[model samples]
Target: MAADATKSTAGRTVFRHRLSTRAWHWLNALTVIVMLMSGLMIFNAHPRLYWGHAGANADPAWLEIGATPTEGILKVGALTLPTTGVLGRWTDRHGVVQTRAFPGWATIPTDYSLAGARRWHLAFAWVLVIGGALYGVASLINRHIQRDLAPSRGELAPRHIWRDIKDHARGRLPGGEAAARYNILQKLSYLAVIFGLLPLMVLSGLGMAPGVDAGWPWIVDLLGGRQSARSIHFLCATALLGFILVHLAMVVIAGPINEIRSMITGRYRLPAERA
Candidate 1:
């Protein structure tokens, strides 16, 4: 049986989040937003991606976004998409039409500032790493990972996993005492983001930094070199962004008031048991 320490009930309301969890959740939210925005600005400095150790403007890019005299375009291999009012070109706050890959509003400083963007990005990168490390240790010490996230053998079975997928697709959320515990899908997604995606993002980020790369050349080498690391880092960030969007949609679907309160005040009103 899954342990639900935070779900111990008083009538319909249950304590649903640890202080550590809530703290980290809020901190991570702010951190990721800043990191993402600044990273976009950084990427705008060179809107091209390649696979090898070295890449240049002259080299072929697997992906590229740029503005021609008439329109903005994003090219992925041979495929191209016109993106005039977004992506490769957009009007900034100053009424100037900008040709940056990402618009100013979506970036830090809201202007073209590679050095400024890198500073903001790198600072928050450390916050993410340190905060994540502390939260990881705290979760382990408190058995949150084991009790909440580690799926049982039965949950891992193909049939059980498929059923959860179907339920989610149909908007069938867990209810009653079941609502007090995470569904298998929630457990798996949380586990992947916490363990797999985040760590790789950090490592790939380090591989792209000149200082880190020079100090630990192996990091870049392991990822197939600096250019490859940058590409992988971009992809990982894209995945994380996707995860955040879906997670937000699920929160809205599952009663945002209750879900948000749980992370804020650590109390949740369990959904009524389906009759």
Candidate 2:
């Protein structure tokens, strides 16, 4: 009985994130935050979204968020919603009124400079792509993607997946040895962000670049068009933001100090099971 219990608790205190993984995680986090903010600042330059091969001031937009003479409005497919201080109209740091899609606080540089924002966005974009490539190679070499992120055969069953979802909803997190490995839901979310959203973001961003489009015109064609790529980039960024929110919430719920420390130091203290 004692030997069995010892085995059960073997992974309660163990190395969770490797040094390379932790480094990549923090670097990616910083770059993603900077990119998102700067991207928003860039978006304010053209606060409209469209579909198809080409869209300009003359063409119709599928979505638009801007300030009219009367109020700030967000228009989507014939629906117009008022967004006052948060979106269209706001008091600036100088106590003067200003109109912008996203407020200064939510943007990089905190001042309206489209050129500065684009520089920041493009500079950090290379950091993200290069760091992400290194991380991906490291993960593959270490089998971290295969062993930890990929779902196991048992975890793929509908019943198993549903059970994990229910457990997560109820805050019934795993403990003991089970806590050492990521849960099915965690695995799926990581995979989606790392493999699906990140790549799509990179590709769409490239498709929007004039230099890239000039060299590889097929990229824009493959993604439908420049406008389509822009729309996809915005959507992927939004999804990444959603993932970050949920990830932070889970960290708080699970154990902020432990979870954060694990990412920082690569050591994790698994939560002990309760009676």
Best model number under lDDT: 1
lDDT of 1 by residue, 186-224 (tens): 999999999989998999999998999899999999999
lDDT of 2 at 253: 85
Q: What would the TM-scores of all predictions be? A: 0.94, 0.95
Candidate 2 residues 1-275, lDDT tens each? 35668556844678899987999999999999999999999999999989877899889998889888868888888999999877877777888778988889889979898999999999999999999999999999999999999999999899999999998898888876677789999999999999999999999999998899999998888899999999999999999999999999999988899889899988888776533
Lowest lDDT 10-residue stretch of candidate 2: 1-10
Lowest lDDT sum, 10 consecutive residues, model 1, at 1-10
Whole-model lDDT values for every prediction: 0.91, 0.90
What TM-score should be assigned to candidate 2? 0.95
Pairs with steric clashes in candidate 1: none
Clashes of 1: 0
